[model samples]
Target: MSAPFVKEIPTLLSLIQCADSLVKNPLTKESPFSVRVAWFDDAAKTQTALLTHYPRLVKESFYTEFEDTVQAGISLLNFQPFWSIMLGVETSQSSAAAESSATMPDSSPIVIPSVAGKDSPPEKSAIR
Candidate 1:
């Protein structure tokens, strides 16, 4: 009997992890600011292409353009989750900073206007 064929799709988490690494360490051992990130369901396919094209693509200019293209593609993808995670990180960091502060405001007041005041002359602070 023939084996059933399977098709694989890379997970969004894997892509996000790779992007995180690129955003963190955007450098390769051989060159600075030179990183190439590509994904395929079949690693062999990617390996074959890399083996065939690595030499031709090993150059500063090539990496510069490659980086730009890769970054552009990453930018095109929905990175809202990544952005939200980053915002959470910032919020935590700020929370820590706020905790360190000697005085933190408990609450702030809100102003409201009444219908009676709406018909009256405007106050100096209410000038629009």
Candidate 2:
């Protein structure tokens, strides 16, 4: 599959679910700008993310009108648990690692970990 990204899908999707943006993007062309927070541990192995953003540089999305033509060979509802776990990556893959079924929140509030790659933007401490 092509490595196409919807800008900041994970971050924007999460933030869109949360409260309003702390600082809206002034030149917001797409109307959606997000953050990639990083997760780190001191001596205690405690995870944390701090959201910060600044106009970096402009680049083109290879898939401005990307589409998925593949049909669902199977229903994913039964795989929700597994998908939850995969999406969680609770044990490894630092950035691609968070929001497990156990850690997934159901209201209240919680800090989200950064699961992006080392080179990618950090993860935002988000709540949904």
Candidate 3:
């Protein structure tokens, strides 16, 4: 959301790499590690996007605990329209498995703050 925050992407990636290394055992080939992320694109008309393809070699990782937490909070405040981004580690068989598992059900209801601004407009339509 801010310039300073955007600059921390590299650092976040490093932390995620470290976490992945800690979670994945070098001796166990079955327990490979990877990072999965979801992001919102204004043009897409969808709230999120996930990694659909795997690169020949995956090298970089991105960790965003604070960012994700903040986004989760914002989503709650904004009536859960969607989150800006979400980051998580995957130790599954493949990226597809990770993507499937990361998706949230549409029926879930997210709670928002009870207080509304005095100047805020009245609700014209009920939230489905």
Candidate 4:
């Protein structure tokens, strides 16, 4: 897949951050599997690395889609100012890279991961 354009880098970065946060703290926490799957669909489209396998997208094909989408969070973390470094994306970053380590066909894909910063507001402020 081609690198994301420089113009879209910041938005991509934000998506990456949100993806990570969602994986750890999903808004879908109380939702059912169907809703979570729909959430994954929407989230994956916003970033390039996840969208790499778009042509293969099948409705309700959850496993491959999950791996590909979640891996995007880990994939681009290998390159910051990601649009620049990802132009020559490392081989390990591809979802296909997980194939070789497969214990069974399409079973347990491995991610070789190798990033930077974020901040959030405090709930309370100090009065001086």
Instruction: Tell me, by TM-score, which candidate is best.
Output: 4
Clashing pairs in 4: none
TM-score of 4: 0.26
The per-model lDDT (C-alpha) reads 0.36, 0.25, 0.31, 0.40
Per-residue lDDT for 1-128 in model 4, tens only? 12222222234335445545555544333567676555444454433343543323333334344445545533433312543344334323444444433333333333322222235444432211
Q: Per-residue error at 33 for model 3, in Å?
A: 37
lDDT tens digits, residues 2-93, model 3? Answer: 33322322332343344344334122223222311111222111111212232211232222332343344345345233332222222233
TM-score of 1: 0.23
In candidate 4, residue 103 scores what lDDT?
Answer: 30
Clashing pairs in 3: none
Ranking by lDDT: 4, 1, 3, 2
Give all TM-scores, in the order shown.
0.23, 0.18, 0.18, 0.26
Writing each residue's lDDT as its tens digit, candidate 2 over 31-97 gives: 2223211111110011111121111211212111110100010121232344345434522443433
